[model samples]
Target chain A: MIDSINPTAKTVGMLIGSIALGFTFHWQLNVLLSLVCLLFLMTSKRAKLSTMVRVLIPIAFISVSYFMTGWLFSSEQALFSLTNETIVAGGRAELINGLNLGTRILAFGMIGISYSLTTDSYDLIVSFIQQAKMPMKVGYAILTAFNLTSLIQTEYEHSKLAIQVRNLPVKGFDTKPLFTMMVRMVRWSERLSLSMEAKGFSEERTMHRQLKIKRRDIAFAAGFPLVILGLGMILAR
Target chain B: MNKKELTLRDYLLMALISVVFGVFYLLAVYAGTALTTVLTPFGLGVLGYEPFYGIWFMAAIITTYLIRKPVVGIVTEMIAALIEVLLGNMFGVIILISAFIQGLGVEVAFAFTGYKKYTYKVTMTSAVTATVLTFIWTGFRNNYLAMDWRIVLAIFVTRLLSSLFFTGYLSKLICDKLDEAGILNSMQTREVHDR
Candidate 1:
C-alpha cells in the first residue's frame, strides 16, 4: 500500500543526501550534492516547484538563524555590521561562519525533502523502528501520532468555519476559538482510540512486513562517512 | 492483575490531547515568523519563537493541567514533541532534546504540588514552571537570552507573560469552552457547569 509513491526515490535521495551531509562541509561538495538532489527534482517524474518551495522555506529560517546566532555577538569582532539592528559581524570570518552554518541547515532540509520525496510515509516509520532498532511497541504508539500531519487540518478548518458560521469574533488574539478547538481535539482523541480497539487492535506480536536493506542502503551509509572524511581533509588543508 | 486499567477511550483521549497540543504548537510556530517581525519593537517579541519557543512548555501545561497528574504532562508533551519531530521539523534532534527540558519545566509544577492534584494554583504553578525552566534553557540556546541581567530579566519576564497569557489562560479558556459544549462533560467541566 505504501508503494504508491516513488518508494525508491526517497530511499535513494535520503541515502545519498544524508551521506553528502555527513561526509563534508566543503562548500563545493555540499553544493554539488544539493544540486544533484535538485536535479532529481527537475527530472523527477513527480517532484514539483511547490515541493521545492515547501522544502526550502524551512531552510531559510534555519539559514537565517545560523547567521543571526553565528555573527551577532556582543564582541568587538563584528562582521559586516548591517544597520540590521541584530549584532552581525561583517568580515570574511563572519561570512564563512554564516555560509558554514547555512549550508549545514540547507543540507538538513534537503535531506529531509529527498527522504520525503522518495519514501512512502508508512515505510519510513517501519524502517525507523524495525531496522533502526527502535521499540516496535513505541513505534506503533507513534502510529497514533500520525493525525498531526493529516486529517487534523480538516478538523481545525471545520472548527474555524463553525465559528465563522456562528459569527463569533474569531479575530485579534482573543483565543476563545483557539481554546474551543483545543478542547474538542482532546475530546476527539478518545473517540478515535475507541475506534482502533473496536476495529481489532491487540497486544499480539506477529511478524511484521519488513523492508530489506538493499545494496543501495549499504552504499549510502558507507559513502556518507567517506565524504565527511574528505571534507575534514579539505578543511585541514 | 486486576489493575483498574485505563480504557481504550482514555488512551484515545491521551492521543487526542497530544494531537490537539500538536496543532496548537504548529499554530504558535507558524504565527511566530509571521507575527514577530511586526511586533518586534512593541516588546511583543516574546510572543514569537526564535529567541525562545515555548510550545513544549505550553503543550505540557495543557495536557498536565487538564489530566491533573504530574508525569502525564511531561511524558505527553515529550511524545507530542517527538511527533512534531517525526512530522519533519528542521530543528531536527535539537528540538527533540529541547522538548524534554521544556516538559520538565511544566512537570516541576506538578512536582511542587507533590504530584497530588490540579487546580488553578497548579495551572499558575505550571505556568510559572514553564516560565522558569524554559527561560533558563533559552538563555544559552538562543544566546540572546544569555546577555546581560537586564536582557535576561527582560527575556524571563517576556516568557513568563507568554506562559500565563498564552499557555495557562488559553488552556483554561479551552477547558471552559469544551465544558459549555458538553463534550468534556465527563471531566471537571461538568461539575463546574452543574454548580
Candidate 2:
C-alpha cells in the first residue's frame, strides 16, 4: 500500500514529517513516532525484515551513543546543585534528556528506512520530473547515471585489480585509478550525450509512467505530520 | 548557445561522478557510525562523523575543480545528495537540505575568486567554508548548541581538518594528478578554448 503512493508525494509527506520530528526532543514522542514508522515498514511488502535488521544494527549503536552523550553533556547540566536530592533529580533529568536524544536517532532511522525501502529509484525520478517540476533533461541525465552504476562498480574493481597487477607505489591515497575512472567516465558522458542527441531525444518527450497526486497523497502529506506532531504535543506533557 | 553554459556532457559527467561519490558517502557514514559508537563513552559521539564529512563534499569539490564552471559545485553536491537518497541513505530527505546548504558554502568560496581560479588556496577556502556552514546546520539539527562547549569545539576542529584533508587537499591532488597525466587535457582544453 505504501509503495502504491506516488514517490514524490511520499517524499514530501515524509520530508515534512521528518522535519517535524527534528524539532521534537521528547523521548516519548520520538519512541511513538519510531514505532509508527516501524509498523509501516513491517507491513510494507518491499521491506525485507533481514535488510531492515541489518540496517538497524548500526543505527542502534549510534542511538545508544547519542543517549550516553546526551546524558553527560546535556545543556540542562547548567542547573547544577550541591544538594543530594537535587543531584539525584538532576541526574534523572539528564538521563531522560539522553533518552530523548537517543530515541530521536531511532525515529529518524525508522522514518528514513520507511521511505527508502518502499520507494523505487526510477519511479522517484519520474515523479520528480512529472510532479516536482524537475527538468526532463536533468531527470534523464540522472536516469542515465543510474544505469551506469553497475558498470561503474565493475570499473572500480577493474581499477583496483590493475593497481595490484601493475605493482603501483600508490597505496592509501592513490589518484591514478581515480583519474583513469574519471577519464573513462568523461568519454562515456561525451559519447552518451552525442548518441542521445542523434536519437532525437528532447525535453518535449512524454513519459511512459504518469504519476498522479491522489487524495491519499494529500492526506499522507498533511496527515503524517499532523498525527506525529499532535501526538508529540499531547505526550510532551 | 552561450559559451559558458553547461552542455549535456557536463550534466552527465556531474551525475555520474555524483553517483560514485554517493557510494563513498555511504561508506563514510558506516565508518562514522562505528567511530561514534566508540567515542560515545566519552560524551563526544558527535565528533565521530566529523572526520568523514569531507567525503560527503568530495563530489562537489572534484566536479567543480574539473569543470571550472560557476555553480557546478552546488549542482554536483545536490545531485550527489539526490543519488544518496536513491541509494537508500539512512539520513533520508533531510540530507537534501543539508546538501543544498553545504553546496552554497562551496559556491560562496569559489564565487569570491570570481569562479576563475581553481588553485589550491581556492579549493581549501571552499572546504573551510563548507565545513563551517554545514557544521552550523548540523549543530542546529543535532542539538549541538545545547552540548558542552568543549565537545562543540572538538567537533568543529575535527570537521575542519577532515574537510581540508579530503575535500580540499585530496581533491586538489587528484585533479592535479589527472592534469599531469594528460587525462584531463581534452576536457580542460575544450573548456579553456570555449572560455
TM-score of each: 0.67, 0.92
The TM-score, computed over Cα atoms with residue i paired to residue i, of candidate 1 is 0.67
Clashing pairs in 2: none
Considering summed lDDT, which 10 consecutive residues are worst modelled in model 1 chain A?
A: A74-83
Native contacts matched by each model: 0.15, 0.56
Instruction: Please give, for residues B5-103, the per-residue lDDT of candidate 1 as tens digits.
Output: 333444445555666556666666677767655543443333346333544465566665455544666666656655654565544334544667677
Tens digits of per-residue lDDT for model 2 on A1-237? Answer: 688888888989888888888776677788877888888888888888887888788878888887887778876442242122234553686776677778988888888888888888899999999999987778888889878888887887688788888886554345666767777777888789889989988788888888899999888888988888888777655
Candidate 1 stretches with Cα past 4 Å from truth are A1-49, A65-119, A128-150, A172-174, A205-208, A212-237, B1-11, B21-23, B35-52, B68-70, B85-88, B92-94, B128-157, B176-195
Which lDDT tens digits does candidate 1 get at residues A1-237? 112323333344344445445434444555655665566556655445775687677566654554444433222222322223245444655555445444655665655555445444466557765566544444555666564546766776677778889887566344565576666766665556556667776555444676767665565555544555566577645
Error of 2 at A39 (Å): 1.2
